[model samples]
Target: MSHSPHNIRTASAEARGRGATAALLIAHCAGMLDLVALPVWVGAALIGSMGLAPAQAGLLVTLFLAGQVMASLVLAPRFGRWPAQRVIVGGFALATLAFASLFLVQTYVLMALLHALGGIGAGTALSCVHGLMGRSANPHRVFAMAGLALGLFGILVLGSGPVIVEKAGAATLFVLFALATFTAAVAALMWLGQSQSVAENQADSSAPTSTQLKAPIPKVVWMGMLGIGCMSLANAMLFSFVERIGMDRGYGLQTVTSILIGVGLFNLVPPVLAALLEKRLAAGRVLLAGPVCQLLLALAVTQVQSLWLFAFAAVVWVGVMIFTHTFLFGLIARLDTSGRALAATPAMLMIGSAIGPLLAGVLVDASGYQGLGLMVAMVAVLAFGCFLRLQWATDNRAAVVPRSSH
Candidate 1:
């Protein structure tokens, strides 16, 4: 009996369903630890009594993003031939160490170095996760799964991290995150394998680029990228600076955690809705829903004063973020008709991710938190335009649902 790659059983409902389950679970579990670790760490770093300055504390955030960028850009392409699961597993183990480094290292400089290393691992793992989501047979389901997992995991981390931080101290709190990372590593080992063949599936499955080359870059993709960047920037701003926001607003640490957790809970909705949809929609629409939600949340940020109101807003913001990113990533994955799509997406996303926090950081420094929040809303306008264009561009391609976006 010969197994032909073209005639793989992955298309069967049973196989595809199982694949989606595994993909979703693995992503959700790992995402919980890695995603929450940074901001929690940021809070710890900025507030720590080591007399570290904001810029110095900011190094941890910078290193994390920089490491993620390096991993996604410099390493992901290199790991093209390696099984995604393998990369993910190794990445998790590295992340565990990275998390541990902060606890064990005394100096900020050393902690930054450790964070960079961890970022390498975390970035690679995340890239592989994104790659896997892209490689799925049911693109919508896969993307939705990623979104759901992200929301669920965000809930876990944000909801849990602060309590743990308060009870166990920062280092011990990280130990718990480390355990989560390790659990994800084990799950990946059990469920994910090298033969997952993400590279092959995406390369072959993505939409064609022949006409794309002849035509201009549709401005839609650029717009989409910008929109995502701004939305994420705002999200990052909240994640990085929410502690200060709370302090300024006379909120407690528990309230801060509640706010973050609220975002996670609200984020939990879109993936479910996205997954339940009967008709397969264009990736752009799928992606657009998230940012649109984010824009709404961003606008409502100033209006919410109570813990409950803030929590509701946070939940919505996070949900929007999960769905939007999951949608865009899936789009990028499926866009590899000409094979350059994967390489291009990482750079675009990384720029967006890094720029978001940096912009927020600058705004906070110059004008304060309210100014930064306004800046986020301003960026969302740009994102909306981009999402609109991308969706409009897809109106002509009725078959866009069945294939990639290149």
Candidate 2:
């Protein structure tokens, strides 16, 4: 009944692979917590603690996002040359240090600078994780898992962040972020070595030559990146103001927070559903459904004043966004194969996010929330058009090959 040596080695390798995947997922979740949750959690703190206006408080978030975009754009393409594990560890260490230093700084400018530096660290960690995930055996599944982790983490942070801020002050949350990164760094240390093997093997067998690795990607991939950027832009615009929107509709703070938590909880559903359906359905069809649903839901949320109805729309909108993002990440991975596009995913998302609030604010000032919703819905429509064109291009190119073979 004893297993052979080869079987033992295979089993050990599989276990290590699972361990590595878990480590990456945890690290990714921790790295993204600030991106998804910090602005909402710290907005009031930033204003109250620093005596800044709401607009100025928002600027801190903008600086942080700008840092992320800058780092991801600059660092993602170097995954082939640099060791991902080292980058991840270094990024986490730097972020943890920055977060820990927040308590020592009092000025808005200094805090903004620290947040930006921390963002660079977080962005580096995220890009490395994305590169690793892109080159994984199952990028779609990894992304879905990562999305689920982030959603669950979002719920936990959203639920607890308010309490922590109220009782302990906003600065405590930064310490918590540092602890989370430290935990991720520990996890990374456990399994990141395994990731090196996976990366090396993928590089060796997939390309076999520098030319193939550096080959030109099609224009459709760039278009798809733009499309994703638009989607993120619209999403950030609405999401950044969602609580305010609810409060403006006469819901209390507690009610708005509850609604947001509900939305975050619902966010976990779509990625799981997408992962399950990915094998059974055409990815193109699934991809196309996401934005269409989002557009309808965006319009619905704006039109309805009922808290229950708006909550329902918000949940569904979040789910659709997650589904769309998972599919899009998969598409980019497939398109590039070199992981560069995958690395750019966070940058594209951050770029849209950075633009979203500005655009939404302008639209709201000119025409109110109704106008904002309409503008975002239009952006979604345009994004859907981009995806449709991508699908058509892919299908047409595929059709050409068989005819040429004949």
Candidate 3:
């Protein structure tokens, strides 16, 4: 019995879909591992082992994010011209080298430079994955899966990272990061090419352009990006200093860590829930719900004195973050079909993450945790307004197009 041509094509498509999913998951997990793990361990190492001032340690993280912003702005837009697989594999290789170089560096400046380089690698890998997801059949589902993978990694790393740092040293964390990136690099070799093909095919089918020209990005897309950035900023402001806040409330380090672990474990819930709910609710509604929940939670935490209450708030905060991020990326995909908007997501998020701590630090120094909470609440309100406008703009655009066609 001979297989029909249509049957063969269906089987081929199925194989490609599986390969693309695997590649996207691996790339996303690799790209985000450093983002999640480095903040936990590297900041402590800089202060405890290297004797850097807290401000200087903060600057190191900023420089690393600066590298990511630079790459997302400079390299990601050019993915259409470059081989996606090569870019991803090269990014992993670069990240591995940068992490390994951390062991050799003793000077603050050198370490900062290496961290920035690693950020570039991470940004590149992340941009490739985002572009691929945006071009896939269902970007919302892809992003949800990506969140789930990151949450799982966060659980393992947050659970064991401090122990590793305590037992061996902070430098060993870099070694583990190197090994993770190397593993991702190896896996990338197998599936990234297939994923790239899927992206190209989708691009051709959706918007075939002469000489690879792209539609001009709309203003609403930029607004959506700004909204996500603000949301991230508000979230990070409190999150970056949650441990200090707990300590100020008289919780011990062990208790604070336990709360954080619970936060990490609870991280797994939102993405899975978002994936299920994406079909039931409008994406804009889901996006709007996140900041609303966050603002209310932030207000509640400000008045709560109990450690358990704070822990509950922290877990809910993580859930809101995962939910917001997944839907926000999906919104970008909808706003800009060319994939540029989604590719810029990491840059926007990193920019906000980079700014939040600095601003929050200043607020805490001047006004204390209560003041910080108030300011974060205000920011969340602003973010919600942005999302509201984005929804309106999207609706108006949809309305205008059909009317103009008539």
Task: Using TM-score, give the best candidate's number.
Answer: 2
- On a 0 to 100 scale, what is the lDDT of residue 74 in model 3? 79
Per-candidate count of clashing residue pairs (backbone under 3 Å): 7, 0, 0
Per-residue lDDT tens digits of candidate 3, residues 11-40? Answer: 876676677677778778777663355435
The RMSD of every model to the true structure, in order and in angstroms, is: 5.4, 3.0, 3.0
Pairwise TM-score winner, candidates 1 and 3: 3
Better of 2 and 3 by TM-score: 2
Candidate 1 per-residue C-alpha lDDT over 1-406 given as tens digits, one digit per residue, 9 for 90 to 100: 9877656744543454465357546645564343444456556534443445444555566676667777877654443455567777888899888877677777767887887787677667766665554545555566676566667777777778777766766677657667777877787776655555332334443333355434433334555556666666666665566655665677777677777777667667877776775256656666666666665666566545665655566556555666566666556544432223343334445455555555656666677767766777766677777777767765655455545533
Off by over 4 Å in 1: 1-24, 27-39, 48-54, 75-80, 197-223, 278-292, 302-308, 329-334, 337-350, 396-406
- Report, for every candidate in turn, its global Cα lDDT versus the true structure: 0.61, 0.74, 0.73
Give the worst 10-residue stretch by lDDT in candidate 3.
204-213
Best by lDDT: 2
TM-score of 2: 0.89
* Candidate that beats the other on lDDT, 1 or 3, i.e. the better one: 3
